[model samples]
Target: MNEPGYAIRAEQLTKRFGDFIAVNEITFDVKQGEIYGFLGANGAGKTTAIRMLIGLLSPSSGIATVAGFDVYKETENIKRNIGYMSQRFSLYEDLTVKENIRFYGGVYGLSSSEIRDKTDFLLKKLELEHARNMLISSLPLGWKQKLAFSIAVIHDPKIVFLDEPTGGVDPITRRQFWNLIYEASSKGVTVFVTTHYMDESEYCDRVSIMVDGRIAALDTPRGLKRIFHASSMDEVFLKLARPEKVGDI
Candidate 1:
């Protein structure tokens, strides 16, 4: 059984696509109000695992609970308790910023008045009040990314999943996005994020590195560096990615 305080718990979670194994049996826990980073390279099964957690994809075998709801039985409860932002911006390109928020808020079942109030606050916080009426396609990439994140959490879910939220943006924009994530975490929103960028992993409270569909290591960034005897996550990743030598542990 999972402990009372964990926001997410998974035991031997596995996912298979026909003959190929996308995610091997992996187990981990994410605490409440934590910023947990899932780091892995392309084809490393990060997305497949995340999909299972968020109820987007069912696992082949295993037990998993997110926000205290079982992934297999109470998927609707999990969906209601969590928010998700994918790599592709989820907003409609033709809709204005405010309109996009309105649409998503409606889908989440928020009252019109509630949506309006939350939209106002988000626009101010994102400094997008001037562009509230601008079409989503007209906004800069950074602004779009920020807006997408804001909409994802507009209903104030207990947990939010960000999948490569800053994929192609500049360093400055990525830093700014991290600030938003930190703000959300401070407000007691648990953040579960996956990223290929090594530097971003440093911003997390704890990180899990996935290699070949399994979690190879899980620890705080500093602890991981100390254990691996590396100066940066890039080096740590390289060390883990290298082939094991003869007689190696």
Candidate 2:
């Protein structure tokens, strides 16, 4: 279940490899049930920040809390309370849909009966009932994306972190996948997503645009557009990303 207030909190989060700082001192918060988007160009430290938040990578410095547990000291607790789906699908290509779900559920400590029940519900909800027996490799790209997302949260995590969840899917399929995200948020699941697509960023309730490992902008889509004096998210991003400076636009 979600806590009463913030779902995620970060303070001066920093990550470094030798002299290369992958993520600088960045801070942000994600409210319970909110759709929070992390937007940036490739290698802008978006993935690095997410890895720290999800407990997969240790930060060189700074502090963070996910689902009320400290990221550095309470990583296991954070893992238990959150789900993650990376850009790489991460499903076993040879496994059938049902098998993949069962494996992931088991990893999350779900009982067989619970996995079965939840799998049935998810398959129906995703309209994948007919494909439940199909091998994951045989499924279409869009179906696999949706299935991966569903499996990521099958254990009923309070928060779900998606890193470029709809990367290469067609526009229509991407819209459908977003509908699923909306469904999850409506059910009180806080979604933390990262994407390069400015259009997708607009769908977020709030967005943080990262540049050179720092948050260059953070606000609602309308707020961003208003602040940047732009007509759309693309224009807003361009203005922030100009070589001159964030304020030059």
Candidate 3:
């Protein structure tokens, strides 16, 4: 059964590689339908923690759950309840837009009719009907990014994980991408995203900052600004995640 109110829960969740700890004991919970931002600098273990949470990597210690499925015991069920979009975008370049939608919809166990119906709806909603027959490779980066995200949640997953989804897009594209995110959130889909864009932090319902494989702060963007005594999320992130001067990793 799903957790009463939390979409994700972890108590002292940790991971280790040899003697080195990749994700030190971290505890947190994401409430249902919340936009939870996961932020960390390079080597801070945000990805490792996500890997363990999403069942790609086993945690070395502690307990965790996603969509009420135990990370240790119900990994397959967790996979079924969550959608994932990687930074590189997961569409096959050779596949037409319609083809990719059909492929992923089938992968999620939707029937032929369901896929067909959703494909039409998605194409129209994203204004991609004109491009539905075109190869994914021929689409602009923004189009591909939006298509990838739409495909990720085509099954209406309980949660969606976006890993640096807006990495190289222009400002307008990023704004458009976030509009989709807001629409999803309004529909009760939990969003767990990892991004370096400080401005994006303001959009999140709550944000967690990681430093040296440990979460140094977790709060609402406004709360974080107050706690860090800063004027913006950028200053808060810098104070907690970047203790060293520029040129330091």
lDDT of 2 at 107: 97
lDDT of 1 by residue, 1-249 (tens): 466779999899999999999999999999999999999888899999999999899999999999999999899999999999998778899999989999999999999999999999999999999998999999999999989999999999999999999989999999999999999999999999999999999999999999999998999999999999889998788777663741264
Candidate 1 minimal-lDDT segment of 10 residues:
240-249
lDDT of each: 0.93, 0.92, 0.93
Better of 2 and 3 by TM-score: 3
Candidate 3 ranges beyond 4 A from true positions: 1-3, 244-249
Q: Which of 1 and 2 is the better model by TM-score? A: 1
TM-score quality measure for candidate 2: 0.95
Clashes of each: 0, 0, 0
Which sections of candidate 1 miss by over 4 Å? 244-249
Error of 2 at 33 (Å): 0.5
Candidate closer to the true structure by lDDT (higher is better), 2 or 3 = 3
TM-score for candidate 1:
0.96
